[model samples]
Target: MKRVLTEAELKDLLQAQPEWKLQEGKLIREWTFSNFLGSMAFVNRVATIAEEAGHHPDIEIHYNHVVLALISHDAGGITRRDAAMAAKISTELASHTSPKHE
Candidate 1:
């Protein structure tokens, strides 16, 4: 059975996912894009990843900002899986924002 992340575990995870932070007792992260389409595209990509991981997040998307909150209902709190998924999402977001060289 999956287990909830302890304070120590959550701290360690946070060390790796510096871009993510705890907000209102939830693991939260936000990303901003240039336009609505860009935000939608990022949300779609995040949805795909969430589906593949079997872990869904609470998301709030606006014209250029997307906020994600992760928690495990079964575990009744945050878990390592949530942290891992957050890390993956952060990496993808970073790659998406990075300038590409031809």
Candidate 2:
């Protein structure tokens, strides 16, 4: 079973991931895309990453925005797994292309 992160550890992790925020005990990040296609593409990549990691996040999709929320439900809080997943998602985000304005 994974262990929940202590407050100190969480703080360090958050510092390293400026785009992510801790809210209501979950690690959350939001991405803005130029259109629905861009947003869906990001979501698809996230789905694959989450499947490989075996740590799925709660994802919310709007027309041009996607929000990812990660928490270890079994651990009842954030864990190293969540941090790792967030990092992977961030890495994917860096390589993703924004939708072109037509």
User: Pick by lDDT: which candidate is best?
Assistant: 2
Tens digits of per-residue lDDT, candidate 1, 1-102, equal 689888898888888877788877789887778889988888898889999889999999878888889988788889888888888887776777522221
**TM-score against native, each model:** 0.88, 0.91
Q: Candidate 2 on 25-79: residue-level lDDT in tens?
A: 9998887898899899889988898898888999999999888899999999999
What residue runs in model 2 are displaced by over 4 Å at the alpha carbon? Answer: 97-102
lDDT of each: 0.82, 0.87
Model 1 global lDDT (CA atoms, 0 to 1):
0.82
**Count of residue pairs whose backbone atoms collide, per candidate:** 0, 0
lDDT of 2: 0.87
- Model 1 stretches astray by more than 4 angstroms: 98-102
